[model samples]
Target: MAIRAAGEHKQRITINIAIDGLRLRDEKTGDCLYHHPVHKISFIAQDMIDSRAFGYIFGSPDTGRRFFGIKTDKAASQVKCREIDM
Candidate 1:
């Protein structure tokens, strides 16, 4: 599923569970947003991005953190089932 937040600037993110690991991509330009091999992620942070929504903050500590602005449980479950830290 794509990321959506009401009253916010437009962004396109699609989450996928690949054989190698978790993948986040941009649908409009065919760019990979974030990708991590299974068991390589350092942490998963659950927090509010703004007043409008809450999502995940995940990445290896050495690489810094990245955000995935997911809006629903179903979307989160999709990521979790793939062996993500969250």
Candidate 2:
């Protein structure tokens, strides 16, 4: 855990993500199927003591599959604002 004071935000949290491509394989032939890119995100609290989550995202970026997507007025109103639990 790395801690740096940003000033005026005590319990501020940060989310770090890494996006990489993984090869998919076929079951019968054991051949490469396709390259799938996934996003892995990690959450860290400002205190640097308690960490929150480790999640993976595999979906369309424009539509924002499942847990993540663009937040617009329509989307925001449709979705509730709360802590994400997985």
Candidate 3:
């Protein structure tokens, strides 16, 4: 997944994910933005151990927030700052 701003002056990011690796590239020039290795986990036998774990924990598919981060607590503060700047 990637996101781009509207204008040429703006920057864009392109992210690629794989089983054992992840890479991010710049959309405009096809430059390597970032690269990282990921650990692969297999849950094939996990289903046999606990069938109930395969189902959703919260019952609702959309119950959780779309974005999560250490900076999530500062979201309101950041919005307030932007509002003041406006």
Candidate 4:
């Protein structure tokens, strides 16, 4: 998880994701389903993090999928939404 300094009034946050790059090799045929990367994977989990409107958002690569949620001030309880595909 990564935290970014967003606004002066509220705190902004972002997430970091890292997937397995190695391919699954077949036992019998010795076939590879996926190929691994030569170098370490480096990518931003969320492209955009804002609190100007309803909440914060992170756009997908194609802009078709989005992951977002609302902001909360209460420490005891918090409200957030799931990833919505648009």
Each model's lDDT: 0.57, 0.33, 0.35, 0.32
Q: Model 2, 1-86: lDDT tens per residue?
A: 22344445223222221245444344456566444343322221121222222223455657554432222223232122221222
Candidate 2 is scored at a TM of: 0.25
Candidate 2: where are CA atoms >4 Å away? 1-20, 38-55, 63-86
For model 3, which pairs clash? Answer: none
Report the C-alpha displacement of residue 9, candidate 1, in angstroms.
2.2
The prediction achieving the highest TM-score against the true structure is: 1
What tens-digit string does per-residue lDDT give for candidate 4 at 1-86? 43335434433333222243323344456666334331322221222444222333333456443333334333212222221110
lDDT score, candidate 3: 0.35
Over 6-35, each residue of candidate 3 has an lDDT whose tens digit, in order, gives 434434555455554445578788898655
TM-score of 3: 0.33
Clashing pairs in 4: none
Alpha carbon RMSD to native, model 3: 19.2
Give the C-alpha miss distance for residue 75 in model 4, angstroms. 36
Write the number of the candidate with greater lDDT, choosing between 1 and 3: 1
- Cα displacement (Å) at residue 15, model 3: 0.6
Clashes of each: 0, 0, 0, 0
In Å, residue 57's CA in model 4 sits off its true spot by: 19
Model 1 per-residue lDDT tens digits across residues 1-86 = 43234556466576676667777788788799778675665444334343333355566678777665554434344445445433
Predictions: Cα RMSD each: 6.1, 16.4, 19.2, 16.8
